[model samples]
Target: MRILHTADWHIGRRLHGFDLTKEQNHAFEQIEQIALDEHVDGIIMAGDLYDRSMPSEAAVAQLNQMLQQLNLVDKVPLYAISGNHDSAIRLSTGTPWFKSTQFYMYTRLEQAFKPVELPDTQLFLLPYFEPFAAQQYFNDDSLQHLEQAIVPIVAKMKTLFDPNKKHLLVAHFFVAGSATTDSETQLKVGGLAAVPAGLLKDFDYVALGHLHGKNALHAKNARYSGSPLKFSLSETKQEKGVFIVDTEPFKITFKPLTPLKNVQQLTEYFETLEDKDFYKDLQLDNYFGITLKDRKPIPNVMARLREIYPNIIALNRADGYETNVEGSGESGKQIRQKDPIELLSDFYKQVAKDDLSPQQIKWAQEALKIAAKRESK
Candidate 1:
């Protein structure tokens, strides 16, 4: 069975103040084409079907239309789950009847235990869950953190594994070593905080979500399908796509999806930016993160620049000329300031002489919070 693995649709997502309806629709077109061309057995959507927990009515309508096209029109089996950004109870609607059309959607932790058995594979559709929920499900109060809570779940899932068929664990969580971008919200405490990759070794293929980049985690058996769209400027270079996984031989391949308007970055002086010839032939419609090298602020600089590049998301001053308001001028996240994460990252690079690890970043964030509380007291 060759299934298409995709995740983190973020259906209602917006870039800066621009509605991503056009861009998102274009991405879906490519995905539809891929499904048709490949003649995939099934499509697995890991999680984050919506941009927010309570999605807009239009967003809901759009997703409905997309599902109708993919499952109903194309006649393909879809296996999906709700991520941290989704309301599981809300998404659980119509799930009981979804299986009639071969649409398998799992939201609750309890539902994950039951596998969707196929001819060549068994899929464990695990949705994003809080550590507390896992603790309650297993009746183990001792399972306080994600790493601890998932231990029993892994052990139980392994017991159900059949040597006759290949097993795929479809889940959404911050797998411990996976890199993250600014776009993803940190489910710090209650949710699946950080799951170790070692626990997921028994499965033939671990289809993961949460992180926007597919290459975020590089484990042998596990691979993140990533997001179909670039939600942040940090993901400009990331190749967005769906993974085609074969169960019999156990092979996975990433096929790229081209976005309507890709995220981009431009670093230049104020004078050069105003030059008509310099900006000519460029995809000005693409989301841009611009950096200014000019030492002095130009009058009506943003107002003028907007005429040329209307899709600028972030603007930064490399010269350290601070803006009165961070995100008020022209672009959101304007004149980008070094936050705790970046500051700590720089500090670690200087002191330890190596980039800070994800664990170290967590420690720094916690330490900063403790210090802030102390100062306030």
Candidate 2:
């Protein structure tokens, strides 16, 4: 049986304050088309259906439309589980009717025990769970960490595995030795935790989530299908796609997807960036993190660059030039040349390491004016 493996849709995700709804919708279209074209038997969504636990109304609508088209209309069985980013309670609300539509969604750990048995494969879909949940479920207080909690669970799953059919484990936890990017929220951020890859040798294939790159893990049975779109500038080089796994023939195929607007990084000087020839072949709509090699600061640099590259996410200096700020960057003489608001803005940027919002600047201006009036009195 051939099935499509995918994870980390992050439907409501944004990049540097920009809404990604359009790009996400475009990705959903491609995924739907791919599923129909491949004529796969099943679609495996490991975890992270949305970017946040409380997704927007629009996000909900967007996901519902795509899911209806695939699961209800197309008649492909969808096996999914909730990740760290999803609200399991919300997802499980109307799940009673899901089975009729061939939608098997595993939100709680209790649902994971019963494997979704296909003709040629048995899928064990496990959602993201805390150590405390496992601790209580098994009545084992010794389950302190993620790995410690999962080992016993997997042992129980091994007992339920069918002898005739191939086994596939779908999960959303950090595995040991898996390479991670900034886009993924590290499951082990608290401490030494990741489930050891060697512990999962029983499965024919391990469809993973949480990591946005397909090449994150190096285990023989495991693979991260990765995010459908580039969520971070760090993921510029990552080939975003879905993985197709065949049970009988025992094959894995990666089919790439083209993002509507991809994340990218570029480094160039002031004059080079402005040249039309330099950017002629480049995708202007792609999100960019740029570094300028100019030694001296250019006036209204971001404004000038934005006219050509509309989606520049970040701008930095190659030499780490810190101008219009206090102490290290600018002399007191240069600081004195600036207006009160300019000085306050620069000082705020230096101290806070962020730009002053317009509302904040307005409040500061009023405070400065009040100070001036008091001085006159």
Candidate 3:
């Protein structure tokens, strides 16, 4: 069977303050086109269908439209699982409806034993789960680590797995030896979260998620279909795409997805940025993280840059400029002058090394308000 492996859709994700709805929709279209062109029998999405537990209406609608095109229109079987970022209970809705169609979605731990049987293959879907949940489900107190927690689940699947046929494991976890980026949240499950690749080496193919790079893990048959779009400035060099695997002959090929806008970095003064001819040849539609070498901020800098490069996502001062802000020198009490929300946001940026998403900021603001009210009382 010819199958396409993809993961980490993060459908509702935003880059800093920039909404990525249009870019996300474009990427979905490309996936649909790939499915149609490849004529794959099935598509396996490892996990993380959405960027957050509670997605916006527009994000939900985008997913609905894409699923309609892939499952109903193209008529390819889709098997997906919920990842760490997903709310398992919420994603479990419409289970009966999904099973009736070519869609198979798994969110709970018990779903691992039952494989999705195909013509000559068996697919085991394992969604993201906490170590405590796994321990309770199995009633095994000895399950102190992630690998130990998964051991019993894999043992159960082994009994049902047909060695005569091709077997694939679609799961979301941090496998040992996988390269990690800042975009990933460290799952502090028992403080031991990495699972050895050797445990999954028996499967014909292992389609994984939770790691953002395609080659995050180095197992023989395991690979990550990295996030379709770049999520962080740290991932600027990643080649985003999906993996195509042929089961019969056991061959795998990677097909890169055309990004809506490439992510690049430019460090120069305002004069260098004004060299329109230089950047025009480099494609203005690409997203950029600009660094200003000038001593002071330029007036209407973003406005002027947008006229040439319309997709700038981030900008900051280069070296030798310290304003006691988040990225500036860390020895000043300038943050005390800001409001509670701003101070909290700056602190978060300092720790996380990335700006908080709009949703996170909103939640932080509400929490700060509650704290302030309590103090007033």
**Candidates' lDDT values, in order?**
0.86, 0.87, 0.84
Which stretch of 10 consecutive residues in model 3 shows the poorest summed lDDT? 183-192
Better of 2 and 3 by TM-score: 2
Residue 364 alpha-carbon offset, candidate 3, angstroms: 32
User: Sort by TM-score, best first: what order?
Assistant: 2, 1, 3
The deviation in Å at residue 103 for candidate 1 is 0.4
What tens-digit string does per-residue lDDT give for candidate 1 at 1-377? 89899999999988888899888889999998998899999899999999898999989999999998999999999999999889999899999998999999999998889999998788999999888898899998998887888899989888888889889999998888887665544433325578889999889899998888888888988988888988888788799999998876778889999889889889999889889888887888878899999766465667778898988898888786644433234332532465878866754565455998889888988999999999999
Tell me, by lDDT, which candidate is best: 2
Over 4 Å off, model 3: 185-192, 294-300, 322-377
Clashes of each: 0, 0, 0
TM-scores for every candidate against the unseen true structure:
0.83, 0.87, 0.81
lDDT of 2 at 377: 100
Per-residue CA lDDT of model 2 for 1-377, tens digit only, reads: 88899999987888999999899888888888888898998899989999889999999999888888899888989999999889999888678789888899899997788998887788999999988989989999999999899988999999998899899999998898888767554444733368999889989999998888999987878999988988777888899999888877788899999888888888999899899999999999889999999866566788889999999999998898645433446676976887999888776776567899999999999999999999999
- Per-residue lDDT of 70-156 in model 3, one digit per residue for the tens? 888888899999998888988887876987777999999888878999879999999998888888888988888788898888888
Residue 73 lDDT in model 2? 88
Error of 1 at 351 (Å): 44
lDDT of 2: 0.87
